[model samples]
Target chain A: MSGKVTNGAGEGTGGSAEGLDAAFFARWMRAAADAVDREADRLTELDSAIGDADHGGNMRRGFEAVRSELDEGVPATPGSVLMTAGRKLVSTVGGASGPLYGTLLRRTGKTLGDAEVVTGEELAGALSAGIDAVAQLGGATAGDKTMLDALRPAADALADSGGKDLRAARTAAEKGAEETTPLQARKGRASYLGERSIGHQDPGAASAALLMAALAEAGGDAEGSA
Target chain B: MADTSEGARVGIVLVSHSKQVADAVSSMAAALAGVPDAPVTGAGGLPDGGLGTSEEVITEAARRVDAGAGVALLADLGSAVLTVKTLLAEGDELPDPSRLLDAPLVEGAIGAVVTAAGGGDLAAVAAAAEEAYSYRKV
Candidate 1:
């Protein structure tokens, strides 16, 4: 449903005919939900090794909360849907994950705001907001070996690509996730372990990659259903 | 049940291992006005089981929200969950026990509370909370 930018393209805010819509957003979240449920144990295992052992449980409770919140009914706008999800995390998750992840979605949602349909620029802004929020919340710089290690590049690529389609976004996100392995810990729970946090990919960063994967899958599903 | 009135949204209480986590999440809410001002309220959990009973904390938090709006409680672990559960069971009326558990912490809580504040039903808000879980990485 999206056509390339024939109009002025420099500003990047011009609405895209193919940008993610409500259904696509829902599918993305659904994929995210599934990834969390499937990997809850692994996340906890990672947390147990370096950070607190509750990462799995913490994430489990957080996603379960999101499920309940969304089951109430599909939201009208993408921003509203994401914002609701973000707020619930802040209130219910109860850990660093709560704020970090919550801030990501909340800031992303805020960027989407009350818009009826989100364009590529808006989506890029939202994703960038999410990445920035995570960094601010976790206090992790680029080399910190946290979720930002993955998320920063993902957002950058999305903006650089101009939010063309899910394929490019997914590729960037996965690459970003993979990049975390070589970096040393500089902040967050992983940072506390110093060198131990290195070599082993950060659970949060891994999960962040999973979220992007889900987003790609969701977009595919939405297209398939359509 | 849907309420046309705006005052019926639930109040959100944030619980975390440290005050920093709570404050960080609360700051997100502060950025938006539709969700209750201070809808994100946080309490620090003391190690060595010093955080007090679940009932005590939830009841106190519940008091901040009106009966019409109700309240949703999200916590870290140990006594935090138990305390919210305890308060839900013993409180004058439960805000919907389902809302207490399995809801997504990050995306779920934010979505639920923001939606509720926007005049969404308890059932709807609760579902949104649960749906937030979908954003997680497995």
Candidate 2:
């Protein structure tokens, strides 16, 4: 469906595309929805340890809304797609993650403007802005043992990779999620647990890694002849 | 009591993770309010009445209660606050003067409604709601 595949001279958005268009973004979202669905149980298990046992159900419901919204018809610009999905998630999820994730995508899409296609750096910059908004809304930073723990490092890796290497971002997100196991949470429900919060990976961070992984998987699929 | 400000009366809003709880709080506030036409409302839970916050319900409740003097919003628990903050960040949906007050649920709702019903301004209503935390029960 995507004829934007490059002819050997890669511009680093991936091996096959000079810049990512709306279709690529749609695929990315679909992949993300799939990952959320696949890992929902694990996320819920993590949440039950230190927080409420609804993280998995909340994420699953949120992404399912996004996926169905896309199924109806993806929006014209990549930004609109994300913006639409963000609104849907916010409206349906009914949890803290709903607003947090909604703000991340909605703010990022807003930053992207109405551009049909955007470079990896542009996406990186927009994503960084989104992450910043999440931090402000949550009032927590990199070491807070929240989604920011995974998302902050993931965004940094994407920026450091010049935004072209979703793989690097994926690795950073997964590693960051894993590293949260030893940290006591300073924000969100887990914070109430205090010392007990340690030894449990944050559910939000785990889901964030799933998101990054889906992005990388989509990038890989786009570069291939599928 | 005569409303010192010329704008519409201040409104009170309560947000909880459960719809029943929010509505009950609103009822309690209304029953003890200082005015006949109390501009107070409560909203919570998802569309299915599940345990979680709803941005749509919050926005709708805020708008419904707003009387131009603005609204003082209070939420229960973590996600409820986060959801309210997200709506505030959007900067458009809710009434411009509406604010998310940092206060306890039942106490804040009752305090905010009483203040607003007595014709308090937006700032006064918010302060009264927030000050609900001061009266500690030992």
Candidate 3:
């Protein structure tokens, strides 16, 4: 409920911003779902090389369920919105992505607490907590050629950006995801491929980057509206 | 936890990437245990019938089979295990006494279901499942 907000210059001024509300969080989820839907095929293709070739489909199904749950009723607070989405994803999506991503959002939402409006600083902190939960649940770290490749960098960037500059966080996530292409996978199904996984981009990392991009896009739209 | 006076036993849920495999294993375990309606549930396959494990399916199966004591979950692969662990970590709608076993899927399912049918408690059933880890064909 209480956190510093950023002004148009992307500087924190210790006040609440109008755009950081449940509605904005809802838009962010929708945008991320759309991104997943748009890129599901590509994600699946990436998985085919080193995984079971189902990442795209799994993500698409998970986000679609999230979309439906959001449609039913938007929660009163940003934290609840994310918690609801996270639970829906955990119950609906199959495979490792479900648990990893679900933990990310659920832990983030829990960190957000009952705040109706959250500042970038609070959101960044919550996201860091969420990312940490994901890492703990999957036993994955950066350089594992997993979603953490993108998510860890994005969290660091978001925290460093003072939780206001979504674009900077998105860029960092994209770069991190790209950096995974040449690394050998050490976690999840891709690990089974061993040396063969060296040249492939990780599907989970790719999807994580897309989700960051969606966050950036949603932030931009909120700023534009404001 | 519910009343076990009527011999209500812990349930077992098998999580696998393939629906066919989960079904076959659970059915075989049920037949072997001679408990036709044994609390052995299969939570496998993607929603679209693809080769993956669904959290929804697992959650539903856990709810369906939980008679009171608790549920024991056995997963076939890494992701399946991770999914169940994540589900339990949430501590949301899942049955309170449930646990995930770190044992071989086929053998664990058999051991856990038989124990549950024999009115084993949650810990005992979970122990039965984990005991399958020492199973050797030799």
Q: What lDDT tens digits, residue by residue, belong to model 1 across residues B7-66?
A: 556666665555566546656754553533545455545322332222333445556654
Ranking by TM-score: 2, 3, 1
What is the C-alpha lDDT profile of model 2 across A1-226, one tens digit per residue? 2222332245333334457777767777888898888889999999999988999999999999999999999888878988998888888888899999999999999999999888777888999999999999889888889999899888898888777777777888889999999999999999999999999999999999888887777677332222
CAPRI grade, predicted model 2: high
TM-score-superior candidate, 2 or 3: 2
Per-prediction DockQ, in order? 0.04, 0.83, 0.72
Q: How high is each candidate's TM-score?
A: 0.60, 0.91, 0.90
Model 3 Cα lDDT, one tens digit per residue, A94-197: 76888888888989999999987888878899999999999898888889899999998888988886787777777788889889999999998889889899
- Of candidates 2 and 1, the better by DockQ: 2
* Ranking of all candidate structures by their DockQ, best first: 2, 3, 1
Q: True contacts preserved, each candidate? A: 0.00, 0.86, 0.80
For model 2 the TM-score comes to 0.91
Task: Write the number of the candidate with greater TM-score, choosing between 1 and 3.
Answer: 3
Candidate 3 per-residue lDDT over residues B1-138, each given as its tens digit: 234647777888999989889989999999988977888988888766778778778888899998877888999986788889987887876798778888899998898899888788887777888998787789
